[model samples]
Target chain A: MIILTAAPHMAVWGKWLGDALGTNAAGAPAGNAVFGIFLSLLVYLIGQWLFKVGKGFFLFQPLFVGMVLGIFILFLMAKVFGTTTAEFYKSAYKPGGDIIFWFLNPATIAFAIPLYRRNDIVKRFWLEITLSLIIGLVVSLFFIYGAARLLGLNDIGIASMLPQAATTAIAMPIAAATGGNAAITAMACILNAVIIYALGGWLVKFFRLNNDPIGAGLGLGTAGHTVGSAKALQLGSIQESMASIAVVIISIVVDIVVPPFAAFMGLK
Target chain B: MASQDKVPQTETTEEKPSPIIVQMAIFAAVLFVSSLISPLFPPSFPVPTPVIGLIILYFLLASHIVKLRNVEKFGDFMISLIAFLFVPSGIQLAASLDILKAQGIQIVSVVLIATIVMLVVVAYTTAGMIWIRKHVFHRSVDVKS
Candidate 1:
């Protein structure tokens, strides 16, 4: 809404995916959280529609189902536009696939509230949070380095991929500095999010573990960023609070530890 | 009287603090102050502001300076935005495809192993902490003469 209404041109710089996708009839109205919110809502609506009316494959996730419809639209429009369609999304798909990380910053800050509520739980379980972070840091780095070496990865690959589990905006730059792969960093970030979401809760439950807010929040937040904390929150408000705190603590610690540790271990 | 009355009065007294907004303000403050000069009243590493903010909030809640429910509202809001914040990471995947293609198999293998190790280690430690807290921290009340 803001960009579309106030300054339309700024959309090009936001994210490459949106830019490419925009060339058609359906570029984002504006490049902001509101738009993301709308996109998310659209996904939900499509999901419900597919769940109700669609058959076979499309009957599953509405957002994904909607995305398929949008793709078909793209194919149709391409056929209609012919040569002109090729030029349409050039700006959108330009080298970066048309995406920028606009909304993630707020989501990161939003974690503080959960962290706040579970401070005592953290204090009570300080040992657990600290230990979990230290162990996670050591283990993640060690395995990444050891596996890389055994697989005969070059120094650059080892360095770059080491910090992918941290946040992207921060990790991309770090990967660049260390001669690591930024793309790998990106994959690691997403992969880590997936891991955190899937296992973060069950792992805790599996152990029938006890945690206060800080310990739980710190553990999840640091290991997986915002997504990790989100999983922690599902455990309860107490875990959410601690996990938020942990995300910050762990991001900083891992940020420091990852490069040095990787270089030390990988000998790059 | 003071403890009971004060607790009830405060609980009933005011409009609930919007946890999300308040936390945002605090996060901004932490980010800013951290950039300039972060004080270490409580021990920490790398970024001191988060720890300081964590401790300050902790004190406020524990000492009854702030209500838990109010704090909870803010905490829950952060959890809601987790996936949205991570969308950027997903976007970066396109950028990584080149690197991934070049070293895809090797890199992914390492990542897989690392992730598994982290999950196991953290889980083990967490379970241990729970064990200690339950058994060591609590004294049995049973008395037999």
Candidate 2:
């Protein structure tokens, strides 16, 4: 929640960045996806050149720069040419965006691949994953509700806010069910990534970690999605796999959990 | 270099698969079949057909029912399609301009707070489990040892 605690300034910047990128895109013929990929490659190359490093930091990535470039590309597409193919890019992307239901079928099945790869991991810790998901989801909502009360954002706002801790694909459904705007969920996704990057080091120190890698990965993935997965991957291959698994599992879990919890609260 | 190449000409050669196109066709055929049968998984199952197709494909891959290298091209095609599925959905924010403007700040603030809270708590809980493992669980093991 450190991000929320320090949000006003970031929102200002996020909106401004989104607007500026959108404005810049108004004139380009390059579609957002192609542009996003090239721009991301350019940033990584720039990061490499700036550090005079070879393949190192390209590997040393949390992918925030690349994701920002994705957002920036979208902003440009939307602001600059919201009229043409720009509109199609938003909905046609398969799993997470417009054709979202496309993901539901596949994500659950993709779980089977991980299940195949980590049969032993699943056998040992499937229960742990389940238990942690429930406990984490509950604690997350409780804290969010409590914070909303403290901030005077009202019960409906608190209920809408509760799902924000999950991935955008997962959170948006819950928010839409509870009357929250999906755009905010997208903004929240980017903002959450930024906040975690900025404060992740401090949180690790505050927790006085004894090099507990899975804990780090799960924590990061449950909240941060690919950004955190990339971070965990940088920590080590084992951590990366676990974090990736956690991101998928946790998002799916939230997809099932958060909306029902809101329903129980009678938020809608 | 010509002499080096000739040494292999005298050696036994390994048989290779016909072509990537053949493998891809096989893979796509598998996907098409699985998608057709996925609904047969019954009401108890929650996942849809295409992913079920992937699972069946993965098994065929992992169990040596199919060679990994053979399916690489087809697998890459499907996975790439899976990843970018969100670009189009993100643009809906623009389409819903009036709706968003009406609730923008409220939605942003609620989501912002929830996102941060979720991260910190999940982090803390994870850290807590490790702490318990080290102190309570590991200490008991240490005493037994």
Candidate 3:
């Protein structure tokens, strides 16, 4: 009910705001990218504010909430202003959004700091950690491939599903290389994160893994990616550190391993 | 090292980078080099440059070529908001609505189930390894001693 009422109002206000700022909602494509990014951040901030005041309404994770807000507003704008969704996304959203996406690799590289801080612990169990991530990596691949096949999805779906467990930095390229839609891979990655963010702690507790932060971190990072890592941070520094290492190792290993194996199996 | 108290207590003094320019320059150089080499592999078997960039940074730290204090703050700033970098991609899911509406539920379920199983499996494997190390390995060492 709220979304129904609020979306249209928000759309109208957003158009008005854009006009007041002298950027037409329907304008040349050149500046729309910058406006799109600004709009995304603005909507995200609003989502954050709403989450805080709503006491984490619906267990709202900020990124997911922000994505929903962006989608809703963009959809509403398209409907109200008579623009196609394709054009709006391409001209208005992708350019600005792509700038932020480019930074993702750097942000991932920055994880080296945490891994460095936890170097001693990592070294002590490097062998075990590596072994566990390899195992987790293999299992993740098989699970997705097997499940998608069982569900009767075609090659593109199977390819996208295979790398769903890894972060987007790794998943996107792999998906494209293996004949999957990169967008589907991104969607799968986000959905995977949402699953982990929502249920990760409970799963940790249920399995009595909370007592072992390394394992807990491995599990979270293996399946959850960034959102899982976020949950791990709440568990403790060990879990957070282990998760950071796991996320990095899992991505590197999957990148090296998935493609050749896919070809051998004749997977799309 | 996982425990905050276990790390040697450093007096809470802020250490500024002696030359922030050099530090930033090194990061940029590493990133550039990694990106250059990443595409050398076949497209079907591409390596992500960021992973290579991370390895270079890690080696730099491990070899004491760069002090943690020099790049630590910048690294922390980037990583802490790493998820923010992903928001745009998540929003881009809007572009694939037809595919999503068709397979969204199935995809979500697949993600949920696989993730849950993977989480359980990883947790138990780590915990079991810890147990074996503590009980079996330590017991054998004690017996030998």
Evaluate residue B28 in candidate 1 and report its C-alpha lDDT on the 0 to 100 scale. Answer: 59
Prediction-by-prediction clash tally: 32, 17, 0
User: A-chain TM-score in candidate 1?
Assistant: 0.57
lDDT of 2: 0.53
Stretches of candidate 2 off by over 4 Å are: A1-111, A149-160, A165-167, A209-211, B1-84, B96-113, B127-145
Candidate 3 CAPRI classification by DockQ = acceptable
lDDT of 2 by residue, B95-136 (tens): 455544565566556555665566566656665664675687
Candidate 3 on B1-145: residue-level lDDT in tens?
A: 5568544444333455536566677678879999998889887787778878888888889998888887876777777777677778888877887777788777777776778877887787777776787787762211112
Compute the DockQ of candidate 3: 0.43
- Candidate 2 TM-score on chain B: 0.50
Output the number of the lDDT-best candidate: 3
Rank all candidate structures by their TM-score, best first, as comma-separated numbers: 3, 1, 2
Q: Pick the candidate with the highest TM-score.
A: 3
Ranking the candidates on lDDT from highest down gives 3, 1, 2
Instruction: Report lDDT per candidate.
Output: 0.53, 0.53, 0.74
Residue by residue across A1-268, what tens digits does model 3's lDDT show? 2222334556566566444433343444555567667877887788778879878654466777778888887777666545556555655677788888888877777777778887887777787788777676676667667787787777877777776666788788887888887887887777777788777878888778887777898889888886788799999877887887787777777787788767866986
Candidate 3: segments with Cα more than 4 A from true spot: A1-30, B1-15, B18-22, B131-145
iRMSD for every model? 6.9, 6.3, 3.0
